[model samples]
Target: MNRKNFLSSLLTIGAAGPVLAAAATPNAVPSVSRNTAASSAALPTPLIIPPYLRPGDVIGITCPAGDITAKEILPATQLIESWGFRIKVGETVGKKDGVFGGTDDERAADFQQMLNDPELSAILCARGGYGAVHIIDRLDFSPLANRPKWIIGFSDVTVLLCHLHTNGNWASIHSKMCNSFPDDWAKAEAIQVECILSIRRALSGERMEYKVPPNVRNRNGRAEAALIGGNLKTIESLAGTRSDIDTAGKILFVEDTGEYLYSIDRMFWHLQRTGKLDRLAGLVVGGFKVKPDDPGEEFGQTVTDIVTARVKGYGYPVCFDFPVGHQKDNYALKYGIPHLLDVQEGAVTLTDTSVPAAATPSL
Candidate 1:
């Protein structure tokens, strides 16, 4: 089906409304309404802060989406281990079940085990491909809802993050996985080194403030709200499902790679028509890498232009080319947490305001 038709079908399902209220149980992250605005009055006041990783804490690594070999993650595993943390490689890692790391059952089982393990302070995804969507809904997130730990990765892992955020009110990290880390920074590009630094900072519970380079397409303004969104394709895929995020009055960040320019425009239009863009407190556009135009046909608009057009009069701060996506400089973002986005004279700054000033010890 075409994008329009597919989006319409999803909207129809969403309009039918949620079939059941999220079960209220101990250690369950309370679910919020999909249509609720993100204003302080609309959202629940309680913010769930997962246990931050401390020295010697254990991090469990699992492949929830794509197939990956043990060799590919060795560098990242060793790096984290060197950071005074223990690493637990899941059973599914290096076990190929066709194009996936393992069967859907295996993938879900591995991730589920990690989620329920109190010894694990975080679960690091091995990599992202296409299979995450298949097992996302199958994972029982309730056990980890209140006793939260970081869920880390981007791309296809967006499905897991969105589901956990929307249905369980859990916070997750949008950052690099094992496959993206390099063993030798001396031979790696500067950006890859930055990626590793970002991961380390995130794991160490350091609240980050970004001075985003100016983008001509950016709308000059400021607002503070919870941050949401990830890979554009993954966000689009969650539409009409239980995982669909409620962006009302929230700062939504999006990025994608290897897609036609026209497809990105269509996805933005989908967001607009579905009212996702209308209620945003801000919009952040990250790296759109290797976007191509058709051989004989051109979209005649850059990703920047398309985004600017879609969010034209909304007036919320819109920062483009903010590094986060299928790129080496992909910085980590904490989703489902309040952040301040300020766009002023020739600069953009994003500050995480979710954590209390006196809360956690810094690295």
Candidate 2:
């Protein structure tokens, strides 16, 4: 379908009028209407991690995005098994044709099998490439809603995270993916385990605290909103699609890698024209990895400078150098989870119980 009709059809979903927040830029992040914050809603108390995996519980692994070979799976699976969970490799785990792990059918099939397996306690992605989008629509999530598990990953994985939150409203993790662990990154693997444990604690009604770094353009004095945004390009591509999210009154987290400063500016401009930045409650940039080409084109731009210009008119809180995005020890975040963003004191806190603890009991 052409982008115009494609978006028009999406806008007319149901009685709840189709909410469209951005109009001018077709490539910018699209907008959606946000529900008002329930100050007394008691905020998210920690998330409930699924039951601890015993030696027999299965840890499902699939390559919904990139392709993986046995080499890619062996070490990763060994690590999971070391944690005592049985490894359930998906059919599409190693089905690669080119850069993608497998065809859309094969990839979606793998995810479907894992999602439907009642014995799998948590499903982990082997890697994050670009194939997830191919199967995102092909797979059914009804089974997943009935048996929600710790679906984890970052980067392109953010696509699934947003869809899961926006469509099924499932709370998932935005932590490191399996690829983050190479043969030598065992220490990295150890940190991932710690992150997984936190996921478990969060799901089991235990809260985790985060240290919000000081901000230069800190805008919100005392405002809190749900956390969202990862891999700026990925998030920007979702605009005008069902996967897109509303940013109003939300802590907008952004980060990018291997992107020219000019490209970053264009994306931000696209975001502005679409109103994604203007309607946001605040802006927080994760480590914006800007690497210039040899004989540098010299765009005379920095990620921080580009973001500031795009968001200056909004006057919401803006923070930078946050330990997120393509970096080690990336901060963990609960997409769609309500959070408090304080600019004056330079701290943002995520409420432990946005979804009542009772509603999401210990897995």
Cα lDDT of model 1 by residue, 167-220, tens digit: 645678899999898878679998788767777777777776677779776788
Superposing every Cα of model 2 onto the true structure, what RMSD results?
9.2
Worst 10 residues of 2 by lDDT: 5-14
Candidates in order, TM-scores: namely: 0.87, 0.76
C-alpha root-mean-square deviation, candidate 1: 8.0
- In the range 168-280, model 2's lDDT, one tens digit per residue, is 44456676666665575445565455554554454333444555657665555445656777878888888887778666556678887888778888889988888777666
Each prediction's whole-model lDDT (CA): 0.77, 0.63
What TM-score should be assigned to candidate 1? 0.87
Candidate 2 residues lying further than 4 Å off, grouped into runs, are 1-57, 82-84, 185-205, 293-296, 345-363
